[model samples]
Target: MTCRLCKRDCQLKNSHIIPEFLYRSLYDEKHRFYRISVEESEKSTFIQKGVREYLLCGDCEQRLSKYERYASTVLQGGVELTVSRDGNLIHIEGIDYVKFKLFSLSILWRSSISSLDIFKQVSLGPHEEKLRKMILAEDAGRDCEYPFIMSPITHEGALQKDLIIQPTKTKLEGHVVYRFTFGGIFWVFVVSGHRIPSVVVSASISTNGKLTMLPREITEMKYISNMATELARKGKV
Candidate 1:
């Protein structure tokens, strides 16, 4: 089997689309794993672990793990970030732009190559090969390329925990956008033909290595809640 990222004709390893640690907060007291589907029928699946694919070779997997470790620290709030709250927006500072940028790109690239149904919305088309090469070379690319914005899902209580919303692709302001929820975080990745706007870039980890976290509102929570309800109705809970 050839490695998807490095194009190496080596034995492929079981690679996780999303890092395993990200799912830690989603487990029940009995250590069971639950998965929810967002299709019209609203199906639910239970498992003991995160989704995996036979994609990368051992070397490539290790390479991606480097970025994942850094990302885990950031997501776990292990790193010191200068945080400020103004109304609904939270501004964060002291981020390592290069590392986080690569981490975000890695997630996007991984989803593009994944065969899992939940990640089906992330076909990169012509951009697929480009991103593969970038990841292989450890190139994060320019800030304007594949820029992204992030927000933490603030839904309280057990009902909203460990929920995974399938990735949805759309166009926003003429640029291609992909939105998905995972590990209590909502991420919006923009595929722009032109350089991303200065304002958007500023908000990204691209400039000055800073970050800003926006709060998810009622409408967003409603969407997840509705999905949960469907799953419950189907006896998937």
Candidate 2:
């Protein structure tokens, strides 16, 4: 099969749909993680590795890994990046607008193109090809083009950093949104052609390389709380 990202008829490598770094904290002492499903019919199970498939070739994988590496460093505070907190809102500065933005877009694009069951809901339709061209050309585009709002998942005033839930699709401010939670952060990407709310655009990565993360509690979201409870009941959390 042709490599999905580069579209070249070359040997495709086992590429992770979601960057492996995001799953590092989710692993257990035995080097395993629980795959929880909110649906009652689908029982939660344990997995030894992150989701992967033959999507990209060696060159394309390396190309995307650069962005992921940068993002992981910033997220893990490996760099001397300044992070400030005000009340419940957290602000991070000194980010590379291009690299960070591309990383976010890559997540959306990869999840959409992935055949993994966890990402089956991410059908981007026309936006899929558009994102492909943008990523291939290293065009992050305007922040408003595919704006995303982020929030840290907190339960009882503590951050939840060890769970990976199924991505969900919803509508926010009349814009289509896809929500993903992993590595203690909840990312909500707004995908639509119509005018997006300015409030939503401002929540995304700024052109000046500033990013904000608002805190959201699990108690406020019934679905997440239910899933957490189910996962805890079945496996070591």
Candidate 3:
């Protein structure tokens, strides 16, 4: 079979649609994580690993893994970041722009190309090819091309880890965006050909290795609250 990322005819590896490290915090005592899906009648389920498919060859997998490793370090606090706060907003600096930006783009591109049911909500259409080329060239592209907003989520004052939600796509400020939750962080990836919203651009990681995160509680998000309520009603959480 041909590899998806490099388009090479070779033996493909079981590549994860979402990097494996993202699921580490979600693992339970049995080394599994609960996957919650509002669209499914089951509501909640357990899995030993993140979603995977035969997408890339060993070489291509390693290439993408490099970016994933960098991202894991940053997200897991392995990298030194200069941090300051203004109200609830947290500004962070000292990031590797190329590595982190490519990592973010890789996730978006992978989800769009993935055939998994969980990622069905993400379909990049024409943007898919553009991203493929960019990733292949290791071009992070401009900040506004595929901007994303990230916020760490909390439940009542406590950081909420151990939860993974199915991605959902929606329109925000006249742009297409996909929402994902994992590692106690909410990600809103804006994928559009037109000019992205200023809010998204400002929140996205800057070329100077700066980023802003809006720390939020679950109660402020009605959709998340509703999902929690439904899961509780089903005795799943």
Candidate 4:
């Protein structure tokens, strides 16, 4: 494959739907449902494939995949981040942590904008409202179990989110707040459409060798790729 952005003989690249490391044990580690109301689909066809992609070659994926552990301490609680798209910037809002939790909490996707949602059957774990609050407050060092929350931060969204993260105190539970800073994928999803193609899940190749059902990550690179192709078609990422 050719590089989706540079078109320089695209090689497989590291595709991060959301970095695996940031969530730590908090990771879902399993499948779940996220629901999206049909308000955004009135004008287009709904994508049936999962959303996500590979921006790395096999070797690159292997190398970058190991870095997730280094940044586990960067995010916690509700977060608000933003992604500024050039042409891909559709109508959207600044990041909202509460909305992110709501969107990510359940994994059902529906055309209805109400409580109609579902997920694959599964067991459960203890609630982490306290841990969630700790992460928001940026208090990882107090545990001594995991430290060094810097160094491996990754970029996200069209604006290249790593460029815009700053620390702020945000409320998570009642009277509970987190002090974590925003970096990497922090604000990108907040600005993207939740009612539309809300939560991106996975990415993979189509049988025809083209990429399909890609999440916001692959779509970002491919959006740039598609634009360049159009320029050749239009003589003009």
Kindly report which residue stretches of model 3 are placed more than 4 angstroms away from their true locations once superposed. 39-44, 230-237
Question: For each candidate, what is the lDDT?
Answer: 0.78, 0.86, 0.87, 0.27
- Tell me how candidate 2 scores on lDDT: 0.86
Where does the lowest 10-residue lDDT sum fall in candidate 3? 36-45
Which candidate achieves the best TM-score against the true structure?
Answer: 3
The candidate that achieves the highest lDDT relative to the unseen native structure = 3
Q: What is the TM-score of each candidate against the true structure?
A: 0.88, 0.91, 0.93, 0.24
Model 2 pairs whose backbones collide: none
Which scores greater on lDDT, model 2 or model 4?
Answer: 2
The lDDT ranking, best first, is 3, 2, 1, 4
Model 4 residue runs over 4 Å out of place are 4-14, 21-30, 35-39, 42-50, 73-237
Local accuracy of candidate 2 as per-residue lDDT tens digits, 27-142: 88998887766555677688888999889999999989999999998777677677899887788888998898899889899999998778989999999999988988998999
- Residues 8-45 of candidate 1 have per-residue lDDT tens digits of 89999999998888888878886668776655465566
Candidate 1 lDDT for residue 211: 79
Better of 2 and 3 by lDDT: 3
RMSD of candidate 3 to true structure, Å: 1.8
Please tell me which model should have the higher TM-score, number 2 or number 4: 2
Clashes (N, CA, C under 3 Å) per candidate: 0, 0, 0, 32
Using TM-score as the yardstick, the better of models 3 and 4 is 3
